[model samples]
Target chain A: MILEGLARLGRSGLGTLERLGRAHLLLAGMVLGIGAVLRRPGLLIAQLFNIGVLSMLIIGVSGLFVGMVLGLQGYYVLAQFGAAESLGVMVAASLVRELGPVVTALLVAGRAGSALTAEIGLMKATEQLSGLEMMAVDPVRRILTPRFFGGVLAMPLLAAMFSAVGVLGGYFVGVGLLGVDSGSFWSQMQSKVDFHEDIVNGVIKSVVFGVVVTWIALFQGHDSVPTSEGVSRATTRSVVHAALAVLGLDFVLTALMFGE
Target chain B: MMGMGKQRGIEILVGLFMAVGFVALFFLAMQVSNLSAAVNSDGYQLTARFSNVGSLKARSPVSMAGVRVGRVEAVSFDKDTYEAVVTMRIDAATDTIPDDTFANIFTAGLLGEQYVALEPGGSMEYLRDGDEIAHTQSALILEQMIGQFLFSKAGGD
Candidate 1:
């Protein structure tokens, strides 16, 4: 029984690896097709609207809450040191450096990622993908390309919104609630945060996460079996995989960005 | 999946969102990396050496009486003395520094950055082009001090 269990473990591990390989191939192709999306700007715009603007309300609301939390936590910690004025610096740096991009990506994956997966999965299950192919349509270019571009374009913007709102939330909590000197909060934040290092690096991280999460969602949907149960399972998998990928990629990017 | 009018609205919304994002980015750059203090200012070079620099880096502020007068241009180790040598670029507008001025490597605030604090000397003549600050003090490393404190406490016990 022990030997059988070991064999089962090895088999499952190999199977998971093989599945990952196929998904990698699919992601590469999906990314390459993004260039073609530019030629069909209308489709790109459509997908951008469907993906980007639709996620704004949730992004803004969550950003405020996250920022407030940071401000509260940072103020309490800093207050013990008698340096509550630096709360702005702490909040801005934390949001711009890490939380803003990562949390935005998580939310985007949960919302738009699942939607993208379900849309594609449903299309696949309904034989619409095959129908498109029968009509001499390159389904990848017609469907997947625009969605990929849209996600990549929207991610940085969403992250920016998150950062901006987070800063405001920090302000409300730190300055308004905690009575940290408003002037020092702003000045200290300005003095400490580097434009290239903090903000731009964050934008870059969000862009990378956006592409990855979108790729995962699309790949899972494309590879799913054509059935109702399969489509729902793919949708769930897309959200979970994209979230994990966002977190994993975030760790690597953080290390690389600040390792110097 | 909507009609033509809705598509136009979505496009408009996307454009507005992108605009807001770019504005936020611009604000971040301007606010965080404030070049207003260092704009178009030609400067003179000055040098100082220290036994320790702590976390001081190039571009660290050189402040005079709580005001930023210049920035550290480069930080290097002297081959012979085995000391940290810091090069500073002082603003041309403020060229009245005396040669006897003491350059102290002190940290700003409790947990803030290490900076060069200039304490002026009582001298008739002003310092000029590529002068070395003869009076220098090294950075106070916190960890070393903490270790010393612990050791002293243990010995006392």
Candidate 2:
């Protein structure tokens, strides 16, 4: 019984290692395929519309709600210390440094990343990828690469919009509703949040997330078995795995960027 | 449903999305953060040495007469003198501060962050890059004040 269990553990460990190696290879291939996709910009533009423009409504709505919640909660907490005037600083700082990129990435993983996986997986199930291969067209270059570039290019923009809307949301709640002085709300935020340190770092985080989330989605879809059940499973796995990867990478990035 | 006109519309929508994204980033960099702050523009460096800095850090405001004139660029320890050497970047426009100006650390509000406040002197020569302020006062520590008070009371008794 002990020997059997040990064998099973070793097999699973090797299986995970194999998956990691395959994912790295896919990443390398995608990097090379970028030139191909760039040669035909229209493909990338179409994917951008599907990935970025479609995701905007959800990102903006969530950002506004999240910011409003932060303002409400921060007011109560800081009011106890008689520092409620720092509401703008608190809201902008938290949104820019932590919530903006991370939340946008999670939402994108759920919204766009899964859709990419499903579409690609369905194409695989229908042998469309093989059909392209038979015609001497590389699916990774013609299809996956464009989608990958779209996600990477779209992520930072979505994160930026989320943060800007979030700050406005906080302003509406803190100044308009909570009676905090309007001048202090904006001035304090301008003084406290450094552009290079906070906003640039947030953009960097979003770009990294875009690369990671889209890569996982593509790899999972490509690796899935060519069946309906397999496509569904790949879609589910892509979301779960991308989310976990994002959260884990976020902790490491935050520690590196913000830790003293 | 996927016609040439629809294709053109999609491309236009994508272009609009990218434009909006750039605007959002501009808003974040320009309005939300301190990108347009005077500290980022051309400046001259000045050094001040304090016996104790006490929570003063890089990027803290360096103000003259309650108006921000520069920012603390770096803080380092001078092992030979056991003092904290602070580097400040004074804005080029505020170049009239005299060489003998006194630099004192002050807290903005109760339990708020500390900043370097400058008191101008009557000296004709102005401070330039690499100039060191002659007079300096360190951050006040509450514990030191209480200790001095107790010692004075014991001496009176």
Best by lDDT: 2
Q: Global CA lDDT of candidate 2, please? A: 0.93
In candidate 1, position B27 carries an lDDT of: 62
Error of 1 at A64 (Å): 0.9
In model 1, pairs of residues that clash are: none
Give lDDT tens digits, candidate 2, residues A48-69: 9989999999999999999999
Worst 10 residues of 1 chain B by lDDT: B32-41
Reference-based lDDT, each prediction: 0.88, 0.93
Tell me each candidate's RMSD, in Å, in order.
Answer: 3.7, 1.7
Clash count for each candidate, listed in order shown = 0, 0
lDDT of 2 at A176: 88
Per residue, candidate 1 scores C-alpha lDDT tens digits across B2-85 of: 687887887798888788878766666666444444463478899998998898998788999989888898999998999999
Q: List chain B TM-scores, each candidate.
A: 0.75, 0.93
Candidate 1: misplaced stretches above 4 Å?
A1-14, B33-45, B109-112, B122-131, B140-157
